[model samples]
Target: ASHAEGTPGQAVAKAASAATPLAAAGGANHGARAMPGNALPPYPEAAREDGLEGLVRLAVEVDAQGRVSAVRWDARSGVMLLDIAARDAVRLWRFEPARQDGQAVASTVRVALQFRLDAPVGWVAQADTR
Candidate 1:
């Protein structure tokens, strides 16, 4: 739950619910979705050495083109490494692009990525709509 300052590793959070929504606008009616095969950021070795683990909440802006236009740290895992890892990985992610009136529209959404030692690498990311 806590780590020393300046520790290096990927931020993570509690397990996420399945079938989470990506955006609040249009609710589940929007067709935007994350494309498969998104490459998860590698766990920071420094953080791993310290046995650090926590969740990283990120606010991501997906452009109408489905490209990740920007990312901001909404919440940190108390480890700098983890926050950096989550921010870096989520940036490269591609989405289906949110739709409004059947047209692609830019939208902002929050996601929680979990980092746990027991979980397989890159398997802990979940879309958190809240």
Candidate 2:
């Protein structure tokens, strides 16, 4: 069943297939990329209804010792308040440093930050220990 001419759903499938590469290309041009082929969990209805909308793309420079040496904006969200907050928060984030070939290498990352103007999810484990 495709939607092209007499097809029932082939158009939908084709459109979806075409979109993947285009999205990756678009993100690539931004010097960072979204996660590959991983379907993130769908947003909850509460988050949608509460106007919780914020996403910031970051480019982190990984040092030789697998540490974040610096972070910069790959894409800005237009909201200075949110952007500053996200930048500040991302500095505290830890990650498995990127590698090229075999040795640890510096790489940029694109991350999304979604904020919920709702209840807290509780204390962060590392922060609790500290």
Candidate 3:
């Protein structure tokens, strides 16, 4: 949760870290019907491991007001920490209200997070060393 301070130079790094999951399971709600006709949202936390390697998939629900509803996740990487972080973060994202019959209605969305390690291959900074 407290790795490298997410910054511009580490945009990819931050996003990468935020997407890795910590758990792998089933029955996680996955649907995006409620995506408010807007752009996809990013993972909740943009500072996971300061750029760890791998990707994570998640299922979440968006409320009528465009806010994250129920969140379910299973980390494919088998990392509990990363998985928990991803789920926790995604649960807070707000989306554009899904419009149905000119009214806001609740919906579900699925997200796949890709984390690309941007940390120096050999020279890990203090923030990313951990």
Candidate 4:
């Protein structure tokens, strides 16, 4: 399933376990998961005014402390405004750190952010994985 297709403010986050086969195999290792109640990235006002909409794919690194350690784009939304907004917003997000043998570990997770003009202001839909 494609993560790009979704309602505005509805993001789909998926954890890629390429680096950790155990996580992919559903073993004791687990990938970092997004915590509930994290704020959605605010739509860029100028982009909204211009009716811009696109999906941004990001690879976010979550540390053992559940904080975002780094973020890099896996795919860009084309619009600089939208891309920057998504990146900045994800930076403030916290996650449940990946677990390895019952111990916390840092891991990378992929996030898909969709921007739409028709979405209700200040409302973020619940996130799901695809």
**Model 2: residue 52 alpha-carbon error in angstroms:** 7.4
Best-fitting candidate, scored by lDDT: 4
Error of 3 at 14 (Å): 10
lDDT of 3 by residue, 3-120 (tens): 3344322222222212112111112322223222222223334445344455566766777676776877634545554456556656766655444445666765555544444431
Q: Can you write out model 1's per-residue Cα lDDT over 25-130, one digit (the tens) per residue?
A: 4454464466765666667788788898878888888888989888998889999998898899889988777676667788765667766655533333333321
Clash numbers, per candidate: 9, 8, 13, 0
Residues forming the 10-long window of minimal summed lDDT in candidate 1? 9-18
lDDT, each prediction: 0.65, 0.39, 0.42, 0.67
TM-score-best of 2 and 4:
4
RMSD to truth, every model: 7.4, 13.6, 12.8, 7.2
Candidate 2: C-alpha RMSD after superposition: 13.6
Q: What does the lDDT read for residue 127 in candidate 1?
A: 39
Point out the worst 10-residue segment of candidate 2 by lDDT: 121-130
Where does candidate 2 clash, by residue pair?
1-8, 1-9, 2-7, 2-8, 2-9, 2-10, 3-7, 3-8
TM-score per model over all chains: 0.73, 0.46, 0.51, 0.72
Q: Which runs of model 2 end up more than 4 angstroms from their true locations? A: 1-52, 116-130
